[model samples]
Target: MKDTDESIELSKRMIQTGELCGKTTTAFITRMDHPIGNAVGNWLEVLECINVMKSGKGPKDLVNLCLVQAAQMLIQCGAVPSGTLKEGIIMARENLSNGKAYGKFREMVVSQGGDLRCIDKPEDYPRAQFKADVIATSKGFISDINALEIGHIGVMIGAGRNCSEDAIDATAGIWFHRKVGDRVEASDAIATVYTEREETLNSAADSVFQAFSFSEVPVEPEPLITNFVTKDGVSNFSMSIFED
Candidate 1:
């Protein structure tokens, strides 16, 4: 869910709906000022997730967010003591680091008839015919990234479907090198756009470049997880909990 007033209210209503259906529900609202992780698209995202689950590492924001959500689930399921979010987070991280999480995912994939080849050897997956980089035009800190615009660019590049019947190019996607609050120099590769269709590569790259905004000074990004909503109530996440 979005970290907006309307979304907050909607989350409460959603929780109530889940209660009426006799289900436990927890809603986590986060900022969409930028895309969640570095890679954007179908296949690229799958690859990223596979890597994260296998190695217990990825972009900091992505890994941290996943661990937090997992911790919340553990709490709800009685896997950890109540109100001990930190302990739940530690348990989740241990499982991830020890390969148990990926093992379970593999087991489910095989039992459920998913393609074992994708998870076993993702390197065999094909790449797009065309790839181009979005270069930084000026030296500065990345102030903002318009995620909605980035999503539109993804659709334009064939990474996503415009209509239900439109075909999707699994290889088409964007891999961001620099995210918000990161510093960049002129001509640095900010992101790379890929597409099977050469015709859409340039246009997608241009749109990707325009989606990023720079600032002369360092910029602080919005918190990823803003509020947590449950049957009990809503509470803002303490920023201190995330501080190193």
Candidate 2:
């Protein structure tokens, strides 16, 4: 068989094995084409997630995107009522707003022997002393943010590791001041990168600039949820899935 055919057959075999083992496999898809948020290090990422939950304000696109994927997965797995998906989202939003999500996150952190105090004071977390801003060159709305590029920038800046032995700065990361649909002016600071080393910060800043794009006209809001799929078939249950 050809290389592509062999590869396809191997994947099918793996899927069959998974099904035989009574394990359900579902794919959740979304694009973070831009940086996920302000945090990068493992601990710092957790802290950022906690802050998101506490503030009840997350990247609206990111949260809704994940929920739409998850709800579809649940329906595929026969885990919950299709009509309850909206309720699930409302519950999730409320949980985050009421700090329940943050509390749960803290419990997980403490259980794992991580320092919990940093959650309250992100500044207490070690920070990359050097920083720089990425300025927009044109006036327009941010049309796209590339996730992979941002991740690459993080690795270049010491926020992530290139090799298994490489060290990651827990506090190093890029922060975005702008999101999709937000208007930006020329020379406006769109994002900031933090790094322990000056050289690394410069490299990261360059990557950040390359990762962003702007258009004169605003881009249509991308649906947080795309198409929901089940064993039976695909469903266009975007808003309905959330109507609890």
Candidate 3:
């Protein structure tokens, strides 16, 4: 993407251009201002992914993201007709709902020499010894969640580490109970923290709470996917258009 802000006129030159369509089927997906879903730890993220693959229902944002991107890819490859992304999305959803995607995940795990027990049972992974809820103090709308700060809180609680050599607890992380745009009552459970260390739980939970910013105004979240690109063209995603 190019921007228009050149004040001083320099020598203009025509650089070589590359092909974007019909040569190879390529695409990219952009996550707009949010993490894929609310899970901030390894186990929680994997569980969400697994659930989506198996049942086609995890996080709405994530589900739409996967289907829309997959639709574009299918369009690029001539696997689906132009201007018929809904068909492609349905095909993608059927793959998940019918267990094709979930079966593929199992095959991948076995091929990678990872434990296959995690396929059906998330409990096979490392689990937190204890869990606690992060309660909301106000009755208001969830205006924003600082994802970067949440990542830091995860690291602080041993979910992640500062460096490659630093050990990470796979089970330590925060699972959000109230997502962005959700309404919260006073004392509502906004999030849940899972960790092995009891002494560090309060600090970690406190950090999670601080990461949330409440507002009086109700938030209508922007779509996770804004547009789709393929060999055909750029198609801006609109739920209203899709519905009609």
Candidate 4:
């Protein structure tokens, strides 16, 4: 289920009524507007995240956001204690800082019969061979990084599939060096686009470049976890009634 305030309340009520009790459920709540990093392809995204957990050279905001969201959900579901949530964040930060997360991810990749060597050097990974650099237009803090716009550009560049049978170019993606609240000059490089075809690369780069906007002031950071909800038996509050 999408991790919105309404959805979370609904899920809690269903569980309280013993309807969805004992049933395994998964919920995802991502920043619908701004996502982290630049890569969106299946294998490439894995590699990027792995690089993050290994080298600490990637976008910090994106990686940290994902870790915190995952930890919060785990704690809310009782899979892990609430106290451990902070620990999980700490551990994730440490693993990324120390390369432990990278090692663990590499192990998982190998266990799944995938080659770990490919991730050792991302430059060696297959590429579209075409590249374009996104240049900033003004001097200000990065206010937004639209995920949907980035995903759209990824699809256009062949990093994502438009149809079920369509193939995705694992190397055709983006690499972001700037994020929200980061100051940039008018000509600073914000991101780089990679694609197998020159034409696709050009079109994707144009689209992606237009996705970014700047302001004279810094943008306020959005809240990661909005609120928590639970069923109230005494007041007769339930998510089911809200649905009707």
Q: What is the C-alpha lDDT of each candidate?
A: 0.89, 0.67, 0.74, 0.67
Q: How far does residue 71 in candidate 4 sit from its true spot (Å)?
A: 4.2
Global lDDT for candidate 2?
0.67
Per-candidate TM equals: 0.95, 0.77, 0.80, 0.75
Q: Across residues 1-244, which tens digit of lDDT does each residue of candidate 2 receive?
A: 2243453445456556666788754332233444555555565566667667778776766566555554545555666555466655665666667887778878988999987787767767676688899999889988888777777787887778889999877767777888767799999998888878787777778888888878889786555434433333344435444444
Q: What is the per-residue lDDT of model 1 for residues 5-120, given as tens digits with 9 covering 90 to 100?
A: 88889999999999999989989888877998899989999999999999988998898899999998898889996558888888999999999999999999999999989888
The whole-model C-alpha lDDT of candidate 3 against the native structure comes to 0.74
Native RMSD of candidate 3 (Å): 5.5
Off by over 4 Å in 4: 1-28, 56-58, 69-83, 95-98, 227-244
TM-score: which candidate is best?
A: 1
Looking at model 2, the pairs that clash are: 33-145, 33-146, 33-147, 34-145, 34-147, 86-241, 86-242, 86-243
lDDT of 2 at 109: 82
How many residue pairs clash (N, CA or C atoms closer than 3 angstroms) in each of the candidate models, in the order given?
Answer: 0, 8, 0, 2
Residue clash pairs of candidate 1: none
Please give me the total number of clashing residue pairs in predicted model 2.
8
Summarize candidate 3's per-residue lDDT along 1-244 as a digit string, tens digits: 2111121111011111124322544344354354567687888888878878877678777777777777766765788755577888877778888888889889999899998888688767668998889999989998778777887888888898899999888888888888889999999999999988788899889988998889898998776555544444555557553454
The parts of candidate 3 lying over 4 Å away from their true place are 1-29, 81-83, 227-244
lDDT of 2 at 128: 66
lDDT of 4 at 64: 57
